[model samples]
Target: MKISAIHLYAIHLPLHVPFVVSYHSYDYMPSVIVKVETDEGIVGYGEAVADEHVTGESWEGVYQILKNTLAPVVMGKNPMEIEKLHDHMNKTIYGAPTAKAAIDIACFDIMGKKLQQPVYQLIGGRYHDEFPITHVLSIAEPEEMAVEAAAMVEQGYCSFKMKVGTNVSLDVKRIQAVRSKVGEEIAIRVDVNQGWKNSATALTALKQLQDCNLDWVEQPVVADDIDGMVEIKAKSVFPLMIDEGLKGPREMLEIIQKRAADKVNIKLMKCGGIYPAVKLAHQAELAGLECQIGSMVESSIGSAAGFHVAFSKKAITSVELTGPLKFSKDVGNLHYDVPFIRLTDKPGLGVDVNDEMMRELTVFHESVYLKEENV
Candidate 1:
């Protein structure tokens, strides 16, 4: 079926607690949701979250590009032609992956619905019925972080992702405290979020953290420092994971060729959407590099899209799709059993959106019909 109309909504969902990464802090998650309408009366949904520091995009920017630039390109086109639509969108604009991802995800939802299949099946079928999900501990005082880790452990979480990089000594204390509180059984991974200004500082921190038995260290240095990534990877015992540095297959290839990292964190927002994220997973698989599916603190919609990719690819050994858990509420229904997450058998994303709730959360709205000259 041909795409007939497109609708956009800019929403701000309050976080249960403040989410602090090295680059920014958020008490609320700003996201742009897209609804794609087809001639056959089928409708599909998608969501995009833009972090100016991470994806070089803001929610406002994503909304504008999806409405004024990208929508016209996909108007009246087949939603199932995701690859071709991506080609057209790339030619139309550069580096608006977050905006493009919204459309791409919506199209995948449409395809899954039309075929009466789950999105994971559409990708490559599910390799995992339920995979372990990590509970993310935002940057906080060492004791507070440790308490949170202990609480999650009591609730059945076996893994934790700790946000770090603001202060080396404080960070070391944070991990050590959490490890001490949770004991040696829980797996702990740290994401620096490019907070370590350079390789030397990162290496120093990694040195102190070496005895903690970290599952992996993510983005210890800046995004573009391929040489720094290699240096840190070679010097540190912790497995290095590249996050912000990887956006597409080209960067993945570079990371592979240079042996820059032991793992790659694939976020649908960063890599565009499932269409390209699947490609990233395949490339990582072939290169013998493991993958971790990360998140942008998204709602169930965006989180589910990432979950499908993670479930389909065996190379994706680690998952941090805990965005929905951080939010008080979300548009879509994604069930969480602490360390494990599950989606329904419903077609498309399997996670259903709460339209009434979305309306309450919307800050900006727009709709583009095929008859409009904007197309």
Candidate 2:
């Protein structure tokens, strides 16, 4: 079936609590949702999150690109011709990865629906039913962060990722407080979020945090510093996981060749979509590097797309798909316990958008039809 129309919705959902990373504080999540309708009456849903710091994309930019540029290319095309669609997106667009990812995910959803199979199985049969997720504690006071970590532990979460690098002394105190609160046997990972200016500062902070028994450190130095990352990795006692530095399979190969990191974090929006993400994961696995599936603080629609990859891929060593937990509301019917997110048996992404909630959260929306010359 050919795609007949595309709908774009810009939704802003208030966070339950403000999320403070190293560079910015987020009080709300701005996401662009894509709904693809085919002539056969099948509909597929996708979402793209706007993170200027990460993907170099804004909500307005994502919406405009999808509505004006990408939608027209796929308007009358077959959803199953995903490769051709991807090529068109790459050739037409220069740097809008999240915008392209939205279309790719929606096409995959449509393909899964047409075939009457879950997206994960369509990609690859499930290797594991459920993968453990790491709960992230946004940058906060030492005692406050400790309390939050303890509360999450009490709720059945064993893995935790603490945001650090704002202050070395304060970060050390925060890690120590969390370790003391959670006690031994709990896994704690730290994310600097490329906050450290150089390797020397990262080394200084990591030295003090060594006693806290961190599982790993993520993006300790600036994203562009491959040599700095290699230097830090050499001196560091903890394994390093690259996040912002990895854009796609090419970057993954560079990191592997340089021996820069022990793990790589894969976000669908960062690499364009599931196709590239899966390819990157395979490359990482072949290079003997582990993978972590992450998100850009998105709704359940975006999170579910990441979840399908995390569930199906055996190379995924860790998961940070905690977007649903941080948000006060989501568009999809996803199940969340403390550390696990369960997917439905329904075909496609197996998550349905909450139409009423979506309308309430929508800030802007537009529909593009095949007959429209200018969407």
- Clashes per model (N, Cα, C within 3 A): 0, 0
Candidate 1 lDDT by residue in tens digits, 26-139: 989999999999999888999999989887898888999999999988999999988899999999999898998999999999999999999999989989778888889999
The residue pairs in collision within model 1 are none
Report the backbone clash tally of model 2.
Answer: 0
- Show where candidate 2 strays beyond 4 Å: 372-375
My TM-score estimates for the predictions, one after another, are 0.98, 0.97
RMSD in order of candidates: 1.3, 1.6
* Residue-by-residue lDDT tens digits, candidate 2, 283-303: 998999999998898788788
- lDDT (CA) per prediction: 0.90, 0.88
Worst 10 residues of 1 by lDDT: 366-375
